[model samples]
Target: MAAPLDLDQLQTFIAIADTGSFTRAAEEVHRTQSAVSMQMRRLEERIGKQLFEKDGRVNRLSEDGERLLAYARRMLRLNRETIAAFDDRRLEGHVRIGTPDDYADRFLPEIMARFARSNPRVELSVICEPTVNLVEQIRRGTLDLALVTHDDEKGQSEVVRHEPLLWVASSNHAVHEEEVLPLAVGRPTCVWRRAAIDMLDQMERDYRVLFTSWSATVIIASVISGLAVSVLPECALRPGMRVLGESDGFGTLPDCRIGLMRGHTGQPAIVEALARHVSESLDNITLPASEEAGMFDFAAMMAMRPRRHRPNMMPGW
Candidate 1:
């Protein structure tokens, strides 16, 4: 007869795989590093194979670990769904969500505020991280939901919204003629960076990444100050930025797909509600008209308004 697997050990193994550090995983699971190590050892002994290679500074999954990740994810998701099914009340517990920092700063506040109005009793915890990190956290049960860029190679999740990607630069910056295209890009694994680079490569354009940061504000600031250019969602552009003219050979970049993803669980009400709110909010967003003919004049009213700090102002406010 086959031996029964230890659920606790499996959870530990999954945590280690997701976090890539035993110490971090131990802290997340509320166990000591030694305890996490012992659980993994016991799991490996039962399975008769080493799940991870501990040679490097960071713990890397072995062939066995990679093979078991799918099963572990399925089992954990099922466990959570089963528990939720029994406690099918008004979702009074906490719902932890993760999003890219840009999305959190730009669009998430309004959606969350609306959600709060509807579910006042439910607690919401939002974490802002890179898309890859957020996806890993969701898979590891650390987050209840996440909105990230959908990669065709990685497959689609439950799509919430999809918007066109637009190239933007400062109004004062010259297009196509600049020696090295100053680009403000997010960190590695950013979809916008990949899309921008791929488009530039295909067009045979010479460019240099002058600035790279994970903050959308940094990207906007650099572009507004005429220091760099960036590509972002059409809805994210603000005043003082300009979309390059197509006559300058700046057009033809492809669109990026952004979506909401959640683990398979029976709590469809919350997911559906959140999805509806996001879709509606994004659809209603209107970008300012372009100043130049055929090109979006994103800086049309740059002088009309002063940047004021309004505490408690939500996104889209």
Candidate 2:
């Protein structure tokens, strides 16, 4: 019989992929860096496939590793479901949750669906809003839990993930090279907007707010049409966008931390149960470094271009 894939090893693999750093992954798994490294090697041997490759100092998932990710997530979900099914407590209560709109499509559906399946009696009320609004609502006790973005390093809350804030533009846009950067921003309270403006000010770079909206999609659309460049979480980046980095003469932006925030009062059992599910679901979510160029028609953007422009000096958004 083939050697069974160990759950511990798979969990460690997921930690590494989620954080994109072995040291962070080790911290997450409560293991030494060397121990984690050894586990990865052993896992690769058991599977008869190399799982990771070095990207600079970071280990990016290899092609085989990417292929394993889907199966791993499904298997882990099944494991969790089985365990939940055996639990004696059947939780049933209304849990009001809030999240930034950007994450609504990415994680909310799967998380809520899983929770609904396991706790059929529980009622979930999900509200999609900006992080700022969610934070306030959570503080005011209008929300039981919220997924928020903060810059706190001392870990004042339950940190979910650290997403790099990226400057993105149309694939064929060379706006980064222009003297006055045209910025497509969201609401004034948007975290990315604040960070982008602050970074530009600190760098003494000239920038003009060419467009503003409350929607990330609108900002992204403006970017796709080469109207302006905008800052977004790395995971929010799609195929038609280009992510600007150090090589592109862009200043570094702070990492936006996605964390769980709860109301001042103690959480009810059902709320606590939902929070745990949210943590597990989010922990398993690993975003691709950059989507494939062909995923979105590179040709469509090119053909619609009103003017000749140079290729962006960064990877797919």
Candidate 3:
């Protein structure tokens, strides 16, 4: 008969093998060194094989340990899957969601609050990154769903919501022909940065990049401090920022498309519910005239109309 294996012991063994030091493994597992050593000893006894070799002060995984690592990973994954399958009805499965920093800051809190209320047992895992990174993660099956900006030049994915980009700057900054506009931007993969640069180029405006960061907070802070101009969704702008002229002469920077993309085949109903909630939240975003007109859908307007209006009967009647 195969020996019974303990997951905790296996985890400790893997940790020790990876770190090559009991102290490090213990720290990683939030256990004392003696505890880690005890677990490893127990694991070895159960398997009836030496899994590690002590060379001086360092510990190295033996050939048997190397072979068992693969089995350990498979067993752990299966164990987790089994637990999730049984516990899913209680809203306890892990959900991996990806979103850009701007949308995450502006809208995620409210959505998460609503989701939490409905799915009290779910564990939400969020990854905030640029649209490109999020899309890649979604494609790679690392993320369960993503809220990402669409590339206009590229075909659309399953679109959930579409909003337009807007140019914004500090309230104190003035646009002038002589003065060089300082621009704050995110990293290269950011769609907003590309739009900002394209707008500046098309308008024959000379601008200098003053700050660049992947963080929305950093970009907004730089703009708020009167450091630079940036292009962002109208919904992302806070109170202190001012719109630089209404001239669409900068050209349409393309609509910001948000979508829910599943990583692989099977998705929990809770994940789909969260995706729908996110799509619904996008409806609440107010847009400027130019942006609003661009994304206007006849179906949405029809839905907003009052279905029936009854006139009050005259008192004489």
lDDT score at residue 109, model 3, on the 0-100 scale: 80
| Comparison by TM-score, 1 against 3, better one | 1
Please provide TM-scores, in order, for all candidate models, with all chains considered together: 0.59, 0.68, 0.57
lDDT values for all models: 0.68, 0.75, 0.67
Worst 10 residues of 3 by lDDT: 308-317
Q: Ten residues in a row with the worst lDDT in model 2? A: 308-317
lDDT of each residue in 1-317, candidate 2, tens digit only: 88789998998887776666777778899999889989989989999998887655455678898788767867777887778777777776678998877777778877898888778877888998877788779878899988877646334357766666777888787877889999999778676788999999988989999999877778888988898989877557676787776667777777767788877645477777788788777756655325444644334323222210111111110
Cα misplacement distance, residue 79 of candidate 2 (Å): 2.8
Question: Which model scores highest in TM-score?
Answer: 2
Candidate 1 local Cα displacement, residue 158, angstroms: 2.3
How much is the lDDT of residue 294 in candidate 1? 31
CA lDDT, candidate 1, residue 166: 74
Candidate ranking under lDDT, highest first, comes to: 2, 1, 3
Model 1 TM-score, all chains together: 0.59
Model 1 scores worst on lDDT over the 10 consecutive residues at 308-317
Q: List residue ranges in candidate 1 displaced over 4 A.
A: 1-90, 264-272, 288-317
